[model samples]
Target: MRAGVTLRSYASRYWEIYNKISGDNERVVASTFRMGLPEDSELRESLTKKPSEGMWQLMGRIEEYKRLEDDRLQSKSKAPMMNRPRQTGFPFRPRGGLTIQKPTAQMGEVNVTFEEPVHRILDWIKHEPYFRWPNKMGGDPSRRNQNLYCIYHQDKGHTIEQCQVLKDHLGQLVKVGHLKDFVLDPGDRVVG
Candidate 1:
């Protein structure tokens, strides 16, 4: 429902109730609160002598819980770079607070892991990356928010998992001892 007068009018007419605080536009505010708010809202349940007080209390509780959760996660997974030096430009940095992993070069070729911790390449992309965050959460779930570039075609929309044209590209890289760190899905491998 739309905010302001439209929603207020709808709520007052439907609920047959008026807002206690706003004597001037009591009907409008009260109606809106009833219609707009969810059925299982804690604020609604905690309505007291002062409706605003109850709402404020509920907000404070929510903030407290959110902050607590943030603290817990921060202590648990803590970012890898807390004590480490910043990453250099020429060579990408290793993530997870682990030692830097160098590619195992064979003859004239260099093999490296495709997986690297996320970096903010652009300002706008931080909020919305080319690769979406993973649906499941874990120790390294932040990688989900990183931009996933399909190395095979350098495309943004589809990962190699769904790219029929570039099927088994990851396996081929693995076969050649390249991107040894990339987790290979068995279904994506090409079968002769």
Candidate 2:
């Protein structure tokens, strides 16, 4: 089989394991493919320079990138976590709070009632580098009413109050003990 076919197969399997893609559009797949490339590879640079290329053009660059990524993943499996050079540029600050909870099978939906309105909470954290605005939700911009604005999406389709992704992210933070002050628990809730 050709390198392009092999690369596509690898990408398909990768998406199956880690995420669900909504469409088979080559541009979306190529974007995902670029993201999965090993950080050290110059292929990422080339891809960034020519992001509008079709899959046929992208395939020519794939075989070497795939080999590099395979080697990186293999070495990662063998290396001790402490020994690897720390990645720079990610703005994540290690919080002095509670360690992450192991996901439980008994986890059920909980309707969190925050001490303050969510919009206010979001406003407080908006400047944090770790906070990421979600991708713009797609729609016919002219047809939809622009009254409701979602800060998370920075779009007009919905209000921040109605944004499920923002709610879910806040819930995760609360569960991890970072946002305990915002949570309205009847009993004692400790902030990490």
Give model 2's clash tally. Answer: 1
RMSD of 2: 16.6
How big is the positional error of residue 125 in model 2, measured in Å on the Cα after superposition?
A: 1.2
Give the per-residue lDDT of model 2 (tens digit) for 22-87.
444778767877777555447767787878477546654664565555456557667433322222
Q: Identify the runs in model 2 with alpha carbons over 4 angstroms from their true place.
A: 1-107, 187-192
TM-score of each: 0.18, 0.38
Scored by TM-score, the top model is 2
RMSD of each: 19.8, 16.6
Candidate 2 accuracy as TM-score: 0.38
Q: Provide the global lDDT of candidate 1 against the true structure.
A: 0.32
- Estimate the TM-score for candidate 1: 0.18
